[model samples]
Target chain A: MQLTNRSKQVSNKEMTMAEKMYLPSIVQGLAITIKHFFMKKPTIQYPEVKRYLGPVFRGHHVLKRDEQGRERCTACGLCAVACPAEAISMVAAERKKGEENLYREEKYAAVYEINMLRCIFCGLCEEACPKQAVYLRHDRMVPVFLERDDIVYGKDKLVERLDDRYVRMNSEVKATPTEPSLTKAAT
Target chain B: MDLTVLLVKGLIILVIFGITLLIATYSTYAERKVAAFLQDRLGPNRAGPFGLLQPIADAGKMFFKEDFIPAQASKWLFILGPCLAMLTALMSSAVIPFGDSIRLAWDGTNYDIPMQAIEINIGVLYIFGVVSLGVYGIMVGGWASNNKFSLLGAIRAASQNISYEIALGLSLIAILMMTGSLSLRAIVNEQATFFEWNVFTQPLGFIIFLTCAFAECNRTPFDLPECETELVGGYHTEYSSMKLGFYLFAEYINMFVSSAFISSLYFGGYHYPFMNAVHDGLTGSLGEIAGHNIATAIGTVVFFAKIFFFIFFFMWVRWTIPRFRYDQLMNLGWKSLIPLSILNVVVTGAGLLYDIKYTTWLIVVVMVVLALTSNARAPKSQAAPQRA
Candidate 1:
């Protein structure tokens, strides 16, 4: 027969008289508080102030394009397939004649969408992609729009590179990262 | 006919309200700045000239933010909670003598000045009584939130505040014993020299007062009631907008109030070195009043400096210590502080009767003995039996 929740075992009871007194620890605690009262404070100010961000900041998404401006997606559907929440979806379309500069492969994603509502931002899709197309990093704040639809990125909203004033976003400003143990971007 | 006196009283109150509120708000900025500097970083440099305008901006933002009331909350109680908090925070300023009065040379009369917000003879007792009421804000806010965590937080705060109240009152009792007066102005006047300050004479009282201040303000180690880890936002969990702002602002205000009380009681309220020589003693009715007035003004500044020091002290403690366990906190207050405080009173009483000094030594001895004996009387172990 299988057991349910285990019973809580009894603990030994051998309280010392000193422990029972409780004044020493209280004074001890007071001493500690006094020591702290005299010591320096440690708080960081944000915005006008700055601190170093760690190595792995998953800030905003960047869609990598080749030097020739050709999209990097191979239309393998791996990123969509790997998304745990079914947030990503894409439609592949064959490259038109003499339009090879716009397509890195024979087939490319003509219509790609990510349901920001469903997306957990785990960066798993970036890891699962066969082609190094999708990346979530090294950008300023991920702009929050009023509507969820605005956050759900379409092919139109994807940028090949940051606008002129591109600066590397620090890890501190980045979105809260998921597990770093499996930190990778699909290539 | 008596309008002049009433007008002067109102003006003094207005000045105090403005100054204390200004100090408290700026202290918040200072707290942030100090925290930043200690952590080896630059603080707020934006929001108008070295971030002087940050507090104003913060206040504006708080005001404009959508005030959210919880569905389960008692609306009237929730609103009353923060108002009471703000009220208690500001109420303590009534008795503090800011500085010695300076003479006004108008029409060749050169009238004397008065330094206090209002000279209440029973100022110290008033402070004690008013300060205790601060807990109601926490209790009401926490209870009104109607969240289990909030209710638990309220209970913790109620117990913590009540426990610390005893130590606080006992500590003040020792001070009253030394000074033989309860008025804040009289108490400061009594401590003309640095040695005369309760800090030097009744160092035990100073220590106890300092510890109790931390507890009353709900500073670190003793901040189990509003412990953010498990209790989330604690008492103000459901509050949003300006309601939340009031709670946070009230905290800083309380810090200011505690600073004032501590300065008056222990550090000598606004009494500086060689202050009397700086302002020659008044001879005639006008002169005597003038001399005390100058002393009061100087005393006020001194008081402020001490209060700011403690405010900075509060910030320092917040960064230094993590919180205590629930049972551990209770034990510290009830079991340790109360008994030792009682003993301190007893010995202090005896010392008073015998005319014996070196209270510093006596306090140290008692502390040492308390430390040694407490270990021998340790509470029963709760270690779980080893599983096979």
Candidate 2:
């Protein structure tokens, strides 16, 4: 039974003296390697030149902020429940009387941590978020962690900075078209 | 010997030593670069521009590495092994004629100093002896390690070197018979013209010597002694730190020396095509002394160029050919190369008796006819029997 036409029959014939000499074959091999010696090398100088990951690629996690720079997460535990790796944890706290500018909702996350070592970067937390707060940034990747303490990222690392906003590529095309209200709320 | 001559010779020796070491050091880098290039990848370019400082970095690393000697190992012999290897490797270069004499005027006396460390009458024999002794380094190192693999490796090395050295010496004898001299400088002097190069006369001998040299140096395709897959770093398995570095450095030095030897012996060392014409022309234009010195300088450069090409060829072959199975290597060395070299010697002797030009042409014709006839007669593989 032939699997493909590329398969060749194994020959057990005695080698000719010419073949046994190995000089001709060695010259042929040398010719081949010399050709490759001048050929263009395909090595990418990695640290200096990073390859562009596609737009939909899930990478480092980011907690969103509102237009007014208020925290968008409402201390909701839906993202934690949705995470397949169970990598997310949070502490909820009530919004203070004069903290409306700081908190977008009555309740706020006092502490939010994501174990990057455990998280699979599946973007499920982004999907399960009701407040449009959790997102996996397409442009940035989670840097390699050196210590045990560095792997579990808290609000300091995860929260979106006011000056540096996380923007999605073609949000209208990627997001569900049926959910107009969610899109409007996100904008 | 005058004190000034001694001083000059000492300086020349120092220069040769420095060059040998420098070439050996950079060979490691060149080996990596060539390997990477052959595989279509960039080699080391991190340390400095094109990783020029890589060998220096490697030396530093070797120096910093822990000097380890196993409790069960023979300590003194283990230490002596690398030193012996390096010593023999360095010693072989002393007899190689780098170029013709350079005229140096010193203390109101003109001295024509030959560009060789020691112009001994028995340069070829000395080289052969040193090369043979090189295997002892591997053997001692492997044996002293007290490991089964190292012992096997050492045994392989000893047997391999002994077997190949016969063919190596025999192949050389064809050229020695033609030149009728054992001195390397004499052999080089005989092949002053391009066509007169020993390679043209003794092509078979050159091929055999090259194969033997590969086997002698333990380069890939003939590196059975240090078959890393089987021997786990071979003779240097139990070695660490600068000791292991010494073993590796010695191999490179051996490679460099063999390249130089090949250049001097077969390719006509310090001799280029129309060299006499060039020397005469230069002599007519410039003064005699200046022309002669410039010509000698050019010849030296040409000799070095030949050595460099051969070194590259060595690396090229290393990357191209796969390691030979032990039996195959033995078969080639003993059955094929040895017999071929013996035939080459007989042919050379016959050529000398008759017209060498006619004899060489006759041999070429015979080889071509034999190849054609063999190819025509070679049986094709029979088709597999069809199932009933």
Question: Which residue ranges in model 1 land beyond 4 Å of their true spot?
Answer: A1-187, B102-113, B281-298, B366-388
TM-score of chain B of 1: 0.88
Position A109, candidate 1: lDDT: 87
Extract clashing residue pairs from model 2: none
TM-scores for candidates 1 onward, in order: 0.66, 0.92
- Per-residue C-alpha lDDT of model 1 across residues A51-143, encoded as one tens digit per residue: 655445555565667556678887789888888999888889999899898888899888888777777767877777666677665434466
Q: How well is candidate 1 docked (DockQ)?
A: 0.11
Q: Number of the top candidate by DockQ?
A: 2
lDDT of 2 by residue, A20-79 (tens): 768878999999999999999899998888888766778889998988889999978999
lDDT of 1 by residue, B341-386 (tens): 7877777778888776446558667666765676556664555455
Model 1, residue B311: distance off in Å is 0.8
| lDDT over C-alpha atoms for residue B330 of model 2 | 91
Scoring only the A-chain of each prediction against the true A-chain gives TM-scores of 0.61, 0.82
